[model samples]
Target chain A: MEFIAGKYNYWIYVALMMIGFYAMIAKGNLIKKIIGMNVFQTAVFLFYISIAKVREGTAPILWDRTVLYDNPVPHVLILTAIVVSVSTTAVALALIILIYREFGTMEEDEILRIQKNGSAVPPGKPE
Target chain B: MIDFALLFFLVVCAVAAIQMRDLLSSIMLLGIYSFIMAVVWTRLNAVDVAFTEASVGAGITTILLIAALSRTRRMETKQCVPPANLLIYGTVILLTSAVLLYGTLDMPTYGDPGAPAHSHVAPRYLEKSYEEVGVPNVVTAVLASYRGYDTLGETTVIFGAGICVILLLRRKI
Candidate 1:
């Protein structure tokens, strides 16, 4: 009970991480993979932010000398990470745009099939 | 607790986002997930992180995804044939999660003031930030002033990504 009371946050984050992982590894669509990557990244940010919490702490703004403040390091770290996530998402979408133009399908298996059978082979699914 | 409820709702959104047939709706649901995740961040005393998550995750990501969807198919192919080796994949995911849970047993409890994360440099920043940096917002001070290199690195990465996008998307540059 004690462990459960104290560590529920970690357990919840682990579950979220697995959900993202499952989507990333199992989903076939290129965009689905990107969404999964987003989920996975946010789950990680939650883990970092959760640990930075202190029971009675206020937000990291130094409002008064008597008040406890949450750890700011993780907040700073996650801020950078969130921006990085956006830039990566943009770049990935650009790649997806090119992949669509070249192959005309976003399904992972279809892309692989095209790779194996060559572009001259009509796509397995009729357009 | 309210936290658990929010997290449970977040999980539902996550599942629904990935499970949707329309890629557009999936992206929208993901925006909701990030919004709620931002709320969770505020609850955890991370206002700055929550702010970024709200703007970048919910706001920017949704717009980018919709733009991407314009160039591609919105509806996922209807064939729901389960991936091969799904059982093996499930087992692997579960085992890894179990190991991570085990590892968490040694970690400090939620909101432990003495936790390693809250100790060390965090205390120094909290104590000295106002005096040394004159920035009441510790997160901003740490991000832009104290740990300037991380911000610089992030800026470089964004610049690189922008150049990569422009180069990749052009028909003939």
Candidate 2:
């Protein structure tokens, strides 16, 4: 009980990461995979932010000399990371659009079957 | 108490996002999940990060996904993977979770002020940011001046992604 209480935050984030990971690996739809990827990334961010928490501390802004503040490093790191995550998602969405244009579907199994059979979409051109 | 609620909602959202058959609703749950994440961040004193998560994670990501959804099939078309293959994937995921759970054993307890993360450069930044950078918000000071290069690199990456999106989606010759 003590162990669980001590690190419940980490444990929860770990579960979130696994949820995202399972979606990315086990799900068939391309959009589902992308959603899973975002969930996984956010879980990592949550873990880092959790590390920066101080029991009685305030936010990282300078309020008073005598006051404790949460660690500022992870917040800064995650700020940049959040932007990078969106960028990756944007690129991913773009790729998904092109994939749909070429293959006419976003289901992973369908795409793989098309690739293997080389029948649904022509080899060189989409026609 | 609130933290527990938010975490519970988070798990619920993730699971529901997985189980949802409609691609649109799944994306909406993803937004809800990101919003809950932002709340969790604020509770943890990551206001800047929370703002980013709300804007980027919930707002931009959902928009991009929905727009992409507009470009493709809306409903998920899933054919079951054979049970043997499903079992393999499940085993690997569970093993990874076990290893990560093992790792948490060594981590500092939640909100321990004396944790190693606080003993390093974080303390220095908190102590000297007002003197060195003339900024009250240490996160802003560190993001803009202390680690300006990384932010610049992040912007460059975003620019690259923008270019990539334009390249891939624009069909006109």
Going through the candidates in order, their DockQ values are 0.69, 0.73
For model 2, the docking class works out as medium
Write candidate 1's Cα lDDT for B96-115 as tens digits: 89999889989998888888
TM-score for the A-chain in each candidate structure: 0.90, 0.90
TM-score of 1: 0.94
Tens-digit lDDT track of model 2 for B42-129 = 9888999999899889999999999888877788875687899899889989999999999999998888899999997888899998
Task: Identify the runs in model 2 with alpha carbons over 4 angstroms from their true place.
Answer: A120-127, B171-173
Best by lDDT: 2
- DockQ agreement of candidate 2 with the native complex: 0.73
**RMSDs, each prediction?**
2.4, 2.5
Per-residue lDDT, model 2, residue A62, is: 99
Tell how far residue B147 is off in model 1, in angstroms.
0.6
